[model samples]
Target: MKLHGYFRSSAAYRVRIALNLKGVPYEHATVHLLKGEHRTEAWRARHPQGRVPALETDEGAFLIQSPAILEWIEERWPRPPLLPEDALERARVRAVCAIVACDIHPLNNLATLGWLKERLGADQAAVDAWYAHWITEGFAAIERLLAPGPYAFGETPGMADLHIVPQVFNARRFSVPLEAFPRIRAVDEACAAHPAFAAAAPENQPDAA
Candidate 1:
């Protein structure tokens, strides 16, 4: 498998962690998003939305979207399952993943931020504020949603931890104060110590700037 991704892309980062946790070996193809590589015709052909983290499977299947790719990875390689065995626990984990991937991440992604600045005439300060506000609100809910853990669920890192860690990385990148979310912070710190999470970190990516 080959993953097309940018170093700092949170969506890409999630997929990377999932692959690593599953003990799947894959190659990395860096798409320089900053250089508008994702917008080019060549890239669009590979990914209709021209997004980072498009996975080309060994059988010649192309998978797009971070969440979809994650689910695929879980189903294909189920040994170190990313979801809980209990139905309710699985739902809870999915909810937490949705909170980060659907609610928080979309609002603060590169496209949305660029739109706020370029299309809406918002200045840097305003854009930064918009970024931080969504993160704070989303994180508050996630803090309450998380169970007691060294990981997000219980003893092992699951979907929630995979999603949250990347968002926490983004939160800190934007200088969003995280003192209010102790549970979230603890999960982030815990995941940092895991080899899977640490290896997939943005700084550890080959394309990291």
Candidate 2:
């Protein structure tokens, strides 16, 4: 398997953590998003969406989108499971993941920030404000939802951890104050101590600037 990704992408970062936790061995292929490599026609042919973190499986199947790719990773590598066995517990965990993946991440992603700058004439201060507003709103809900634990849902990191850790990275990147979200910061600290999360960090990746 070969994982195509950009070092700083939160979506790509989640998949890296997932694979490491699952103990799956795969090659890493860097797609230089900053250089517009993903926008080239050749890359578009391989991945219609031209996004990072596309997993090329051993069977040569390409998996796109971090959420779907994450689900597939869990299904493909079930041991040390990222989800709980109980149905309701799974939903609760997934809801935490959604808070980051659905509500927070999309609004602050590169394209959205780029559009804010180029299309809407948003200056740095305005862009940072927009980024912090969404993060504060979504993280408040996540803080309430988080379990009193070393991870988002329980003693061990799971799907929720995979999602939140990356967003926390993004939060710090934008200078968003996390003092209001102690639970979220605690989870970040806890995850930092774990090897899987450590190895998947942006600065630890091959292509990190």
TM-score of each: 0.99, 0.98
For model 1 the TM-score comes to: 0.99
Candidate 2 TM-score versus the reference: 0.98
Per-residue lDDT of model 2, residues 1-209, tens digit only: 99999999999999999999999987889999999899889999999977787999999899999999999999988999999999999999999999899999989988889999999999999999999999999999999998879898889999999999999999998889999999999999999999999999999988889
**C-alpha local distance difference test of each model:** 0.94, 0.93
How many pairs of residues in model 2 come into backbone collision? 0
Q: RMSD, each candidate, Å?
A: 0.6, 0.8
- What is the lDDT, from 0 to 100, of the residue 178 in candidate 1? 99
Candidate 1, poorest ten consecutive residues by summed lDDT: 45-54
On TM-score, the leading prediction is 1
The 10-residue segment of model 2 with minimum total lDDT is 46-55
Q: lDDT per residue, candidate 1, 1-209, as tens digits?
A: 99999989999999999999999999999999999999999999989998888999999999999999999999999989999999998999999999999999999988999999999999999999999999999999999999999999989998999999999999999899999999999999999999999999999999999
